[model samples]
Target: MRALALLWGCLALRASAALTCPKEMSGFEGDTVTLRCTYESELRTHPKYWCREVGVFISRCSSKIFSGENSQDVMEGRVSIRDSPGELALVVSLRGLTLKDSGKYWCGAQRLGPDEACPVSLTVVPATAPEATAPEATAPDAAAASPPAGSSRPTTQPDSSSSAVGDPGPASSSHSSMPSVSIPTTRLLAPILVLLALLLAAGLIALSTHMLWGWRQALWAEDAQRGEKVHLPAAARREEEAPAQAPEAEETSAPCRSEEEEEEEEEEPDPAKFIAV
Candidate 1:
């Protein structure tokens, strides 16, 4: 019985030495963390797995989360496990850590007999808050210190009653006397320049329209004068031909009238001889 106990103790020590892992690990909320466990060379072909402890006793791999096949990576939810046979190490990664993720976990390897496991305690802490930044102070404008051109600086005299009651400090006086922020001259001039440009463009357009109307009216008047000049010569020629044609018509009518009078005299000439019969 004593020899059997010694052999069992040596085997337990060997198994403990074969599977080794960190005792504790920590990560911030919303952060990722990696845990590595080294194993003996003889167990390199064994399947490796990661699991979370469920009960208070921290049983070995009670809730398996990820299991690795051969040397390939296996992932379940936010936890992933990968076995590197060359390095004889099992790597497990947990991403997007939360406060509830802090607990006891186990890294284990499967064998024909009992599985070998190592316990790891994880602590997930809340992320730290960022510090507040104070606003920067702005220096007073140099231009505001001097009065503008063509303007007299206004002077203010403190009331005698107020001075007698309490003397105002320099800080208060300086703060109260600080000039209000004056708008930039460029900002004020921008709209004025735009308005002036618009007025100038309107004036130019009106002037052009008036000139076009005047040119069109002059063209119509010129056409009217040219038509009148063309008709005037033709009217004058017709008037001159009318007077010459009128004298010829008068001479032809006078010869006809003399012949008619001679016939009338010859027809009435035998009136004396007929009255004697």
Candidate 2:
């Protein structure tokens, strides 16, 4: 039992020793990438395969690839494997890579020491790079097109670039020829603001007038309730008093009584006074 356990431990250690490849290999999706691995003469007899990496080791690898010079060629779906007898090298061809194919992988021979297994990290990039577009081709204008030889019109080759480079550039001319904004500003906004201000002033005046009138009316009503009456005009009061004093004026204008009638009545005495005597 002890000997069996030791053998198992040694096998596990050998399986753990993985070979090394390019740490990171990047390629565009749908493109083919070649992975070349070299091995020793002792490993030439071992079966080789490719696998997805797990942790530090390889797992879920391809089927055992035929090794030996007799079967020099091997092909799977999109993958191909070849062992070159001259250089003692193993070459793996992976094709039609997708973005999902980017990850760690392993390439190795079966039952070889862990050092023979190769761990490669593959990075598949998107293949959708933008292509450059060519500028549009326009027919030359009549002035710029060269005239046919031997014509007597003496056609001058109009510099196609003359318009672009004038006394003042088109950009400068555009800047200089800008429309006057002051006119529109004064014509459009100034009048509207003035009209709004005038309306506001008129509204304020109307409000003030209404408020003053209401306050005056309220004061007048309160005065009337308190009986602080207003004095009437002289002519109106005189008209009102004239009939009220008519009888008093008539009595005051009458004649006085006689003094002689008062002296004759002085000898008479009361009847009760005479009986007491």
Candidate no. 1 TM-score: 0.41
User: Which candidate should be chosen as best, given TM-score against the real structure?
Assistant: 1
Q: After TM-score superposition, what is the CA distance of residue 273 in candidate 2 from its true location, in Å?
A: 87
lDDT of candidate 1?
Answer: 0.66
The alpha-carbon lDDT assigned to residue 41 of candidate 1 equals: 90
Instruction: Return the number of clashes found in candidate 2.
Output: 2
Where does candidate 1 stray beyond 4 Å? 1-15, 57-60, 132-277
Clashing residue pairs, candidate 2? 17-114, 19-117
| Ten-residue region with minimum lDDT total, candidate 1 | 130-139
lDDT of 2 by residue, 190-239 (tens): 76788899999999999999999999999999988666444446667889
> Roughly what TM-score does model 2 have, to 2 decimal places?
0.38
